[model samples]
Target: MPSRQKKVIFCIAGLLSFGCALSVAVAIGTQFWVKGTILCKTGAQLVNATGPELDKFVGEISYGLFHGQRVKQCGLGGRPFQFSFFPDLLEAIPASIHVSVILFSAVVIIFSLVAAAFFMYNAFGNPYETLHGPLGLYLWNFISCSCGCLVMILFASEVKLHRLSEKIANYKEGNFVYKTHSEEFDRSFWIILFCFTVHFLNILLIRVSGIQFPFQESKETDTSTGAADLMY
Candidate 1:
């Protein structure tokens, strides 16, 4: 490929990285805000004061219901506990909304990398299953390419489910029901990793694909060596 074409390809990869990272940052940041403490406290207070029966209904629609996944995880892991997954899934709606945003970002990342791989494959003219050479490069691009989203599915499933686990009830304090801080951050890190992985792979394809992987041609073709032979 011509130098100008390569430059354009690199620029596009840069744009993809920036867009995906910015999106992941915004989605994760905005999530907890809508499910803020005041909302939880208000629901809990209503449940405690007037009627426990009302609490069930309020919890069903609110973030409190999301904790069922956490309880279920523990139960599945041989921890003896009982909780309804239905309400947990219900409370998880806020997180479900947030995860949809993450999925959107993942989709973008996958497309960006696929474009990069296509560029590299054509530019270098390397065979798809390049034998005995530079397997890492192929693996690198594959992770961010079309296949990356399927890899992301595992993380998405675990984290999205964990979102439901964030809900748990604690003893009431004065006018408010107690708050137990959630674990949304843990899952968020993985989402960020996926975004970064996309950027990393795309950048690697842009920078490295032009050069033969696991092989260097510089020394054999040195210009100085040819000039010295003429002088001798």
Candidate 2:
């Protein structure tokens, strides 16, 4: 590849990495990872609240990794109450799984930043053999891709397969009772997924910048050797 093309590719990859890191950080901090409505199962039945009256029995819930808000419709025109995950709802499975998700997201962000640094160094600076060469680009991008994929898969499994929203809503304490009416992974979840896709696309960008795939080159070399021996 031409020097100009390589520079362009590196710049694009670096910008993408920065975007992914920023998005993951925002997702971690925002209390919008999941959003849904919860119903006061016991209170609704007791008051026979149905139809539009059921709106009075409905509550909105939105949460992230650390803290969230729950607005109860039954009281004070749906006043929102804040809650934290640790020490308050640590016993819940969703909370535990989300803790793992947050950890993996951090890993993804770190790896992405590292990859971006490598891209910039290779583009402009004098790249050394191991950490700033083509091999370094492949290694860093691979790690970033793997970490991003793990973040997406683990969080998706927790939300979809494990029924995270329902579990959190069903958690009870003393006289308080809540049941999940409907739940969905919100913007943060999709943003994380977009980050994953971007990292994966970076892998393709690395190849497009004239770096040969490592295993493919090895296979080609072995095949050439075999053909030469047969000729002999």
Candidate 3:
């Protein structure tokens, strides 16, 4: 690749890495990972509510990894109640899985920033042998991609397979009891997915910048050596 093309590719990859980092950070901090409505099962049963009266027993819930809000619509006009995960709800499996998700997200952000820095360094600054070369780009981008994928997969499993929203809603406290009616991943979840996809795309961008796939390069080297030996 020409010097100008290399610069453009590296710059684009760097910008994408930064975007992934920002998206992961925002997704971690926001309470929009999962959004759904829950029914106040106990409340409905207590009042023997039926038909339209049951509508009053529904509540809105939205939460991320750390904190969230629950709006009680059980005839209370959507009074919001805030909740936290750490120390407060850590005992729950969903909370534990979410904590892991957050950890992986942090990993993704850290490695992505590192990759972006390396990209810029290779593009403009003087690069050394291993740390600032095509190998380094591959390494950093691979790590970021793996971590981002982990974040998405873990969160998705918690929500879809483990029924995270339902678990959180079903948690009871003294006289309070809740039941999940329906749940789905919200904007933050999709943002995380997008970030994962971006990191994977960055890997492709690195390859397009004239860096051979690491394994393929090694295979070619061995094949050349064998051919040379046969000629000798």
**Which of 2 and 3 is the better model by TM-score?**
3
Off by over 4 Å in 1: 32-197, 200-204, 207-209, 213-232
Q: Residue 201's C-alpha lDDT in candidate 3?
A: 89
Q: Order of candidates by TM-score, top first?
A: 3, 2, 1
Task: List CA RMSD, all candidates.
Answer: 13.7, 2.5, 2.1
Q: What is the lDDT of residue 28 in candidate 3?
A: 87
Question: Candidate 1 — what's its lDDT?
Answer: 0.43
Q: In candidate 1, how many clashes are counted?
A: 2
Better of 2 and 3 by lDDT: 3
The backbone clash count of each candidate, in order, is 2, 0, 0
Ten consecutive residues with minimal summed lDDT in candidate 3? 167-176
TM-score of each: 0.32, 0.87, 0.89
Kindly list the per-residue Cα lDDT of model 1 for residues 1-232, writing each as its tens digit. Answer: 5766765665566556556645554544433211222123444454464454333322211222112212111111312233443443334244454445446455655554444455545445544544312443444454554333543454345445543333333321243343333333333445555665765666465455364443344454466689889999
Let me know the TM-score candidate 3 reaches against the reference structure. Answer: 0.89
**Residue range 114-203, candidate 2, lDDT tens digits:** 888888988888887655787777787787777777777887798778876666666664565777888888899888878878878888
Top of the candidates by TM-score = 3
User: 102, model 2: CA deviation in Å?
Assistant: 1.4
For candidate 2, the lDDT comes to: 0.82
